[model samples]
Target: MPSLTLEQANQIIAGALARSKASGFKPMGVAVLDDAGHLKAFAREDGASMFRFEVAQGKAWGAVGMGASSRALMQRAKDNPNFFVSLAATSGGRFLPQTGAVLIKDAAGQVLGAVGASGGTGDEDEAICIAGVESAGLSAG
Candidate 1:
């Protein structure tokens, strides 16, 4: 199975931050995790809050652990609130079923990992993650 390289993770972070800056969103925190849901790289913009990192990582971790985009998880939560809420405790609070994250896939549709962002609306954060994945020559889902 193909794995995500540190260089690629850095590229994704840079791309996400650039897009966020271009769009005039608030300072952001971006996190990239490996297929195993391990932190690969992270960045918090100058003005972002310290808590942004945890929020960003939680969203990405949720995506990687569940094998789906955080947006999908968000919808699932809407359908099964109790189970989804329980999942947060199950993950020890590292999972966030929100719209600010996306799974990263390779050309073969293999899960490479996930990217997530915080410090903006859910839609804005998700947009940056998608842009980052695309800019890094990966697919976002």
Candidate 2:
């Protein structure tokens, strides 16, 4: 029953931003959410769009809610667009089935939270999330 700490959340964001910068990706926004789908931390780099945090949070929120990676949800949504649309409505527009977020898991495979990013391509965004999770000494799902 491990939970994400504020320090870990901040580390995740810092790692994500660092990765984005090292890769020469555009300015990025990152969000972290605990297992209960509550926002734990967030960051938007200078020059990033105002909407980045919302997009990143939406992606992570959906991951924490569904207990899966945003990439996985994106694939599922492709098979059932109607169902996903309904899900979005039920989440009050917070659920976003996109490829920019991943579940954060402990060594025992317990879900601790999720990390998500915006301002890059889907692959780029997902990569940064993974990097952040690993940097925090957690696994990414």
Candidate 3:
């Protein structure tokens, strides 16, 4: 399986933060999780809240674990709230079915990992994640 390189992870973060800044969003936190749901890289902007890392990582972890974007998971959660709650408990709080994460895919459409962000509205967060993935020359799902 193809792996997410650290350099790519760094580029994602840089791009995410740049997008956030350019868009006048709040200080953001970004997280990248490998295909196995392992945290590959993370960053919390200086003014971001302390909870940013866990929230950002949780969203990314959920995307990698469920093989879907966090936005999709959020929609599913709305249809079956109980199951998603159980998933959070089962994940030991590492999973968050929210709208702030996107699955990362290679040019061939292979899932590479996921990118998530926090410290803004869900849409704003999701936008930066997509930007970061694109900036890294990857696609966002």
Candidate 4:
């Protein structure tokens, strides 16, 4: 089983920030988490709110815990609001069923970790996450 390395995590965050800047998005926060849902790397762009870090980490943590993209979790939340709400509590508010996060997978489709972004619109944030994963030579799921 391939695991996410600190180098890769750093690359992901760098790529995400670059993309966000090139796209003219607002100041952003990005987070990378290992498969165990541990923070591997994180960054918050200048001018971003202090809360952006928590929001980014929460999205990635939820993706890692659920073994799915945060976008998917958002859909699930729509279908089961109560359960999803409970899950947020169960995770001590570390879970966020929203867009802007994706599972990081190897070539063999093995999940290595997750990456998440905040401060932009959901679509913009998610796009940067996918871009970051690809920039790191990994797949986004």
Residue 131, candidate 4: how far off, in angstroms?
Answer: 0.6
Alpha-carbon TM-score of each model against the true structure: 0.98, 0.98, 0.97, 0.98
Q: Model 3: runs farther than 4 Å from truth?
A: none
The alpha-carbon deviation from the true structure for residue 101 of candidate 3, after best TM-score superposition, in angstroms, is 0.4
Cα lDDT for residue 129, candidate 3: 97
Order of candidate numbers by lDDT, starting with the best: 1, 4, 2, 3
Error in Å for residue 53 of model 1: 0.6
| lDDT, model 3, position 92 | 88
lDDT per residue (tens digit) for residues 26-77 in model 3: 9999999889888889999988988999999999999988999999999999
Mark the regions of model 2 whose C-alpha exceeds 4 Å error after superposition. Answer: none
Candidate 1: list runs displaced more than 4 Å.
none
lDDT of 1 by residue, 1-141 (tens): 699999999999999999999999999999999999999999999989778999999999999999999999999999899998899998899989989999999888999999999999999999999999999999998
Off by over 4 Å in 4: none
Question: Which has the higher TM-score value, candidate number 1 or candidate number 3?
Answer: 1
Task: Record all residue pairs in model 2 with backbone atoms less than 3 Å apart, i.e. clashing.
Answer: none
TM-score computed on alpha carbons, candidate 3: 0.97
Per-residue lDDT of 50 in model 2: 80
